[model samples]
Target: MNYAKEARDLDFAYKVRHALNESAENLPVATLDRLASARAIALSRKKQEAPAVALAFRGILAGNTGLSFQGPTSWLGKFGVVLPLLVLVMGLFGIYEYEQQQRINDLAEIDVAVLADELPPDAYLDTGFSAFLNKEEE
Candidate 1:
């Protein structure tokens, strides 16, 4: 019995088992199995373990830490509040602009009346060449 090879195989199996257990504690069993197989293959190919182990640890911590305990009033809930406020602000601004346009149109009509009164009496006379030609032809 070659003890060295047996020990190496046992160590590899242990690491794979550890990874699988961590994943299962966090995610579903199928995800755990997939992660375990990938890690085992990577280890068999002599790839690095630091990044993979760190990620697995983070996943386990996130799962066990209960970070999602803040019910509906989390980040998403604030948006529910802010969105309606934004819509109301936009509606008010739209109404203000419409009223402003109506006021400007009314003021324009007043300006037209003032201009008519300010012009001289001769300004209304048709003194252009077309008018002269029309009078001559008539």
Candidate 2:
């Protein structure tokens, strides 16, 4: 359905009602004449515009009489819908793996530092050592 056409018609009706309400009292002859002239001018312009716009639409419809979307178009539309979802899942998995690798690398680095420092194995169990490791990380 053409929603814009319906909305434009409704808007014109609303404006007409509002104008009628505002002009409920009798107006002066000059004001009425000026309004009549303005209405005639506007109606003439609308008549000129309506035919051209209508014929333009008719011409477009006539030209594209055979154009249609089906078969491959339907397949492509489905692929378009699924491709983004597949890409999103793969991207998330890749990010997850990257973060996991980074965490592993961090732990390995901490292990290597402790080995290099030749700390006693007892130091690993000490609560203070945990704080020392965190401070070093900072």
- Per-residue lDDT for 1-138 in model 2, tens only? 599999999999999999997885568888888988999998887744443433343323344333343222455545877889999999999999999999999999988887888677689999998999899999
* Number of the predicted model whose lDDT against the real structure is largest: 2
lDDT on C-alpha atoms for all candidate structures = 0.74, 0.78
Residues forming the 10-long window of minimal summed lDDT in candidate 1: 57-66
Each model's backbone clash number: 0, 0
lDDT of 1: 0.74
Candidate 2 clash pair list: none
The reply for model 2, stretches above 4 Å from the true place, is 1-42, 45-73, 127-138
Sequence-dependent TM-score of model 2: 0.46
Q: Residue 49 deviation, candidate 2, in Å?
A: 7.8
Task: For residues 36-108, write the lDDT of model 1, one tens digit per residue.
Answer: 8999998899955575433344333333334452334455545767889999999999999999999999999
Q: After superposition, how far is residue 136 of candidate 1 from its true place, in Å?
A: 39
